[model samples]
Target: MKKYRIGIVGATGAVGQEIISLLEKREFPVAEARLLASANSAGRQMQACGNLETIQETTADSFKDLDIAIFSAGSKQSLEFAEASRQHGCVVIDNSSAFRMDPLVPLVVPEINPDDLEKHQGIIANPNCSTAVALMGLYPLHKRFGLKRFIASTYQAVSGAGAAGFDALENELKAQFVPEENSSTATKDSPFPHPIAHNLLPHIDDFREDGYTKEELKMKNESRKILGNPSLKVSCTCVRVPVYRAHSISLSAEFSQPVNVPDAKAAIEGFNGAELWDLPNANRYPTPLQYAEKEDCGVGRIRIDQAFDNGLSLWVVGDQLWKGAALNAIQIAETLVEKKCLKWM
Candidate 1:
């Protein structure tokens, strides 16, 4: 067994913390784990692989000695340090939008596209939280029935926005004294334009000229790329809800072949990293709270779509910090190891 020296950029963030915890939980052959963050976050102590480690300020030289680097930092850090990490002979698995659409970088979900790891040019991109969770339901179906298009409505958690978003929701929930007539009475300081404690915000990310938000478009664009189906159409509406950990998506998809509920359920059941939780009699379906902190995304409410011929409607839920970010990034590293794509190989 070979253990590799690893570096985790943005080690102080919500996703970054999850990455560190997952690395220890999964026991991926790690010889050393260096936690890196901003200068302000430097010197902060955190636990990783059973030892309390000091967080360091990330710089160009951060990856000089690491064999693999999993970046949970946002796009700015990824764009600035990813190439530098790669140059240092470290395989960079980036969990940001920085290089996902880049023709050169492989956008991967290990269960769906592990072979794509072989095509990496030092850096690999993880898909959006909603995209990754939704795909856990859609990919198996796509294999059973050729996928053509989908319409998705995502109920995203506040944690998806990171710690600040979580705090904003938490503060508002605690500050509520009276029932305000309007939901807009929410704190103006919230990261979201509206209060997420009780009301829903139909917007996620910046809105585009085409009326779809950047987050919604990410589902469409990233899905197409990962599925290798350029013609696949995705119409998505992303909403921010009060939940604090996982994300849930409602999907109505039309496929080329005729689909049935039983087979659809079976497809999801047989898929890796996905669980079939449909039990209508028991009133069971995938929910964010239930799936929070769980590695496997849950798919339920499987049925034939009423709107489209040869279509199916399903619900999917996954932990935003886990499969959506940290777990997926670590899974990519595991895939790299399994595929022998590391430097030693």
Candidate 2:
């Protein structure tokens, strides 16, 4: 029942702010919480536990006396500060792509691979937002019927790109919709390469030689790690939508054994952390607005995919900032403390 001292890196960013809010909402037993950001945001103030706290510049000394550190900064910042935090006896839960592919680092999804947390050498990597949300519905079904292959197309939000990404989408929409007198000039300062409003960009990250974006590759790679099946085949297409928050995915999964529509619906209904919203009669199913600011991912539109012999088609929606990033990190920290995986000072 002891309280632990915690620090949040990138405290001013979108995902970092969500971490602060979630920690307070969940009533985590935190003795003290430190907010750390870059020099540009060093003097900014944020609320935590009903008190105002100032953000300090993150450095090697930032982890002093902290028991657990949650990192949501970019991969570069995590790569630079993760070891320093660990050296200070702090367990780090990183929400970036920095350590996901590292052989020594464990890519974790609490429901799928909670046991991997025990083998951590002070650092746990949260999977990509698209991967996390997609797996929330798929993992449970995979347990019932062995998974043979996965194919997904993601509709990602602007917030996933950080605050600037949101700003860009706002500015683009204003310019495209508002009257000429009220509209401001749309510039290149926005996150995406082109306007995101009224447009669906088929790219999420850098393009590979094969034309798949980096975000798409993450879904393929991270899924294999979290599912504990290195041989699991996966293909994905990641797209950037104009939404402010939450992400949705259209998935088609092939199983090793034959899976019928009724059984798939039953499996989704009984799964933990997932809910089935299928009602073709009412024309209702999961959507980004339905899952935004919520913890559980909503899944629906279950049916047999005609593309593969044993394939099932489904859609999933989840708050990228919550289940995809902050909540997942907090859950990992909670699991560690609850299981006595780490000692509080």
In terms of TM-score, the best-performing candidate is 1
lDDT of all predictions: 0.91, 0.89
Please provide, for model 2 over 232-295, each residue's C-alpha lDDT reduced to its tens digit, 9 standing for 90 to 100.
9999989999899999999999999898988888888887778888997898898888899998
- Measured against the true structure, the TM-scores of the candidates, in listed sequence, are 0.97, 0.95
Clashes of 1: 0
Q: Which ten contiguous residues of candidate 1 have the minimum total lDDT? A: 177-186
Model 1 bad stretches (over 4 Å) = 177-189
Candidate 2 backbone overlaps, count: 0
Clashes by residue pair, model 2: none
In model 1, how large is the Cα lDDT of residue 285?
91
The model with the greatest lDDT is 1
Error of 2 at 218 (Å): 0.5
**lDDT tens digits by residue: candidate 1, 1-345:** 989889999888889989988988998888999999999999988889878899999999999989989898899999999989988889998898999999888899999988888988899899999999999999999999999999999999999998888888888888883436764655656678877777789989999999999999999999999999888899999999989989999999999998998889889999999999989799899888899999999999998999999999999999989999999999999988889887632
Poorest stretch of ten by lDDT in candidate 2:
177-186
